[model samples]
Target: MIVRITSKFGAVDAVHKTPHTGVDIAITEGTTLRALGEGVVDRIYDGSANIGKGLSIKLDDGTQLIYGHMNEVKARIGEHVHAGEIIGLSGNTGNSTGPHLHLGMKATDGSWLDPTHLADKVANVNWINGPITQIWGLLREKVSEITIDGFTDYLADFIVAFPVIAVVSGGVYALVRILSKGGATWAAIGTMIYGLLIVK
Candidate 1:
């Protein structure tokens, strides 16, 4: 799963029978929601007084995740969603006091399990390419913040420099390939000869 749910699961509300079944995540309405792992969409529901617009997806491992209170369901029933794929947008459509995401999980036996338990499995992004994921997230945020002029300036500089870099790199690669066919001593001799030739 994506491991991006910002809030922990809590006790189900006895009155709602909903909160008791799922965890409420504090999210802004319309925030993009993503699948935590590759899964098939099992169900989709329109907004009701309680559940609102929501979707249920069964993971490859047979665990089912329930996402509720979404503003829009982007995935369709029986569609396969890849890991980290955007499945919907969060919202307060059902019986919610505020905008948030209600998430629930079920085991293969069809019994409701605290989504938190599954979340625990992904608690440590640091262990599973977490740093790279974090870097990518940060980079996305940064790139989004760039203005059109800023992007244009960077693009111009890159366009100007690219050919020069490519030419130099290609020449170096050719030299290295030629020298490597010989040995280290020959490589050194070739480098010295090339240096003299360049100077001359």
Candidate 2:
């Protein structure tokens, strides 16, 4: 995995899905949407372009990405923008169902690659602390990410070690009490140490 996962700002209603030209990612509305790369705002459309209330930025990389159904636009037309710059906010404006960014990346030669494949590379810095390896197992249908198999082992180890530790210390204290004090004067110390050491 590379980095951030950016996609559809919301759900795609029936009308949008009828055409079925994009993918949907469930996210919160108004999450700070960022540019995947340095780009010039080719055009900022608010329910004007065929993309529906979205904006398109033509990056210097010779690739353009269309961000649709935005809640707010932060970039202006013909403005130079850097990668990871806040470009818009997620919203359900036009032909969108929920809150998520739907991106359409176009190459100079006109080829489309799956966004999910490169989602990590362009994602936010949170990827550094992402539990992707552990999370993927949850999405992939693993029944035992956190299993009780080890709990019993750990508890058993603790149980077995506790008595030995307590007994050794308690025996030393009791021996010291007997040798130092002698007679019935030290009898209470032996019983006290033994009682304190044995829990069950």
Candidate 3:
């Protein structure tokens, strides 16, 4: 979890007389924003009346994190961001009264969750800098790519083969009945028609 975090959840603002939606980390403008976890950048929206310039990241565990009131967005849409990577910069944007980073978290269904819990849950893992580690990481990424390709091929094969196998088996059963009834020629024609119907 982030021990360097500043604000607490549900912190009330005296001027606006309302509780905040997420925790605010007071920081100077252009302060580097780091990803609390590994996730893909889901959205990067321009500043608005409410959130200002903000970015949304969807984590591997399906949690959606929102970093609002940014001075700049460094992450791109659909880009995979690793934990501790600089995703953006902090600033007073949107409806904010001062410079701060507004951190919010949501469940898979978009239900609000306490941002503190997520920060507390994440262990700030230190990087092991070495050539071997770098090589291993690259190889792991390649393995993941290959795994997805294999699954796609398997699914495609099953889709193409299932109906044909079912039709052939049914035709064989029909042919057996026709042979027993002394109607081999008609049954062979019917089997061809059945095969055509299956193809269509």
**lDDT string, candidate 3, 134-160, tens digits:** 234334433454566665774676578
Global CA lDDT of candidate 1, please?
0.66
lDDT of each: 0.66, 0.57, 0.66
Separately for all candidates shown, the number of backbone clashes (residues 3 or more apart, or on different chains) is: 7, 16, 2
**Residue-wise lDDT of candidate 2 within 108-151, one digit each (tens)?**
78765445543444345223334443234223322332258745
What TM-score, computed on C-alpha atoms, does each candidate reach? 0.53, 0.51, 0.54
Q: After superposition, how far is residue 186 of candidate 2 from its true place, in Å?
A: 48
Model 1: CA > 4 A from native: 1-19, 117-200
What ranking of all candidate models by TM-score puts the best one first?
A: 3, 1, 2
Where in model 2 is the C-alpha error above 4 Å?
A: 1-20, 48-50, 125-200
Q: Give residue 61's lDDT in candidate 2 (0 to 100).
A: 72
Error of 1 at 40 (Å): 0.5
Ranking 1 against 2 by TM-score, winner: 1
